[model samples]
Target: MIRTSAAALAFLVAALPATAGERMNLGIGTIFDNDAMGDGDDRWRSGSFAISHFRGPEWRGKLPEAPGSFIEWRFRSEIITPENVSGTAITSDRRYVGVLSAGLHTHFQRNGAEVSLGADIVAIGPQTGLDDFQDAVHDLIGTSEPRSAVNQIGNDIVPTVTLEVGRELALAGNGHVRFRPFVEAQAGIETLVRIGGDFTFGGTGMGAFRMRDVVTGQRIDGVIGTADTGLSFLVGGDIAYVADSFYLPSRLGFDLTETRNRLRAGLQYDGEIASVFYGVTWLGEEFEAQPESQVVGTIAINLNF
Candidate 1:
């Protein structure tokens, strides 16, 4: 599957045309938390790199008067290494995520602002390395424990549909500085099947434990089943300084539920041919018991034809 996905991405990138007025962007960055510490469990070190392309109507006089539309596809991958693990032991995991979105954008001339409404389809796959953590827990805590059957704690493909609403405000100097803020909400069902050995412990000789969907309040049978729906919300803003031929973009944002806070600063040089951007990000992850953080730097090359 991984190979197939990689091949597909490569094919898509290669098939894209370099045409006038087309926009393409590629970025690579790491997320690190200076305070994240622990032997083997460096909670603060994880990152993802992505490439995106947007094609839309050109702007006139600082903002486009007519409404425009675009479709964007993003691919990202990240890895997380746990702390306090043993020698040559792999206690971390990796994730591959993809998002496809299409939206309509309108620039309000009177306000010097722009608004975008879009929908996104998201998919995530996790790759775990190491003994099933859930299995270890069951051996120690007993199968009857409420948490014993949560097998394969990390690996799964979660598909979701989300809605996004964002706006950009023009700041001082007509275009020298700008603030872009946006929010996204997502809700969908999560299906769990093919239980990992870690999720279940010895239980009344019943083989493995099972769980019902918390959202739909329905009993789930078979290895794979769908649960009730859940929602996630994100809010953030970017402050950018724009020049005739250069720009700088800074961002601060947070997400609810999962509790993610991020700060990013980067420099961008927009020339007649293409643009190059480099930046770093500080991200915090509020996981149970022990929260993790990371700091990462990124570089991106964009072509605006």
Candidate 2:
């Protein structure tokens, strides 16, 4: 997975249900670039699948002060190709890497704001099948050269924690037109201090605003942003500053340092039984000597019960 800033992490944590909420949500999203449209690099791709289980009355009874809470678990996967992306040889740095990760989180909401915390663990290397899968996919399409998987991280395990603070804003509203804006800031072992916001329109569900807090994963609250089961549409943009990341490539036998900015734009629609979200993001160069930054497109779908 890409290393991002604190603002991204904060936004993600704020979007989830706070440990004792009323509903559950299941969703999947892909973070990629316009390579699918033949307009951008195809080297970096990532996806996330997640589900939120309601905290329920039994759990709320034990913690009455925070009745709307839930446990969220997510599956994360990613593939990186520095050489292919930059179109240059990379020495010492990893050439490619495939990663699979999972995390368990709990969140709470109160007075139009939310607090969240969670932990995730990562596994990297060939066993992850990210590189081979990409190779097979590209072979089917007949690309120039197949990409090699990176082994620098070497089957290591990385554990990180998540924390965030978020606020929901109701700027204006009417039967047909409504506006809501929000802001959040948070820190993760992966992202030091990320901050971002969103402005939403159309309906009054979580689906009415930007649904993703992170480029690759959906936040617990954003997942329920439209939990009321209504027809809604949303459009929004976000920006963030990331301090450092263990996920990005490093050199000199040390983890690389980063403090770049990230920007994203997205649109979404929430319906009665299912919803869809499409978004795109630009990441600042991960390494100083790198040629250019990265652009990725993401799509998310959910089944509501």
Query: Which candidate leads in TM-score?
Result: 2
lDDT of 1 by residue, 22-133 (tens): 5322211112222222122223232333444444334222323333322234333333333322223222321112122221212222244333322222233224322344
User: What lDDT, from 0 to 1, does candidate 2 have?
Assistant: 0.50
Model 2: how far is 158 from its true place, Å?
Answer: 0.9
- For each candidate, the alpha-carbon lDDT, in order, equals 0.29, 0.50
lDDT of 2 at 122: 67
Model 2, clash count? 29
Residue 233's C-alpha lDDT in candidate 1? Answer: 16
**Candidate 2 Cα misplacement greater than 4 A, ranges:** 1-39, 44-68, 83-88, 92-94, 150-152, 174-191, 204-213, 216-243, 249-258
Off by over 4 Å in 1: 1-45, 58-68, 84-155, 188-258
Cα lDDT of model 2 by residue, 78-106, tens digit: 66665454245456344566677766556
Root-mean-square deviation of candidate 2: 6.8
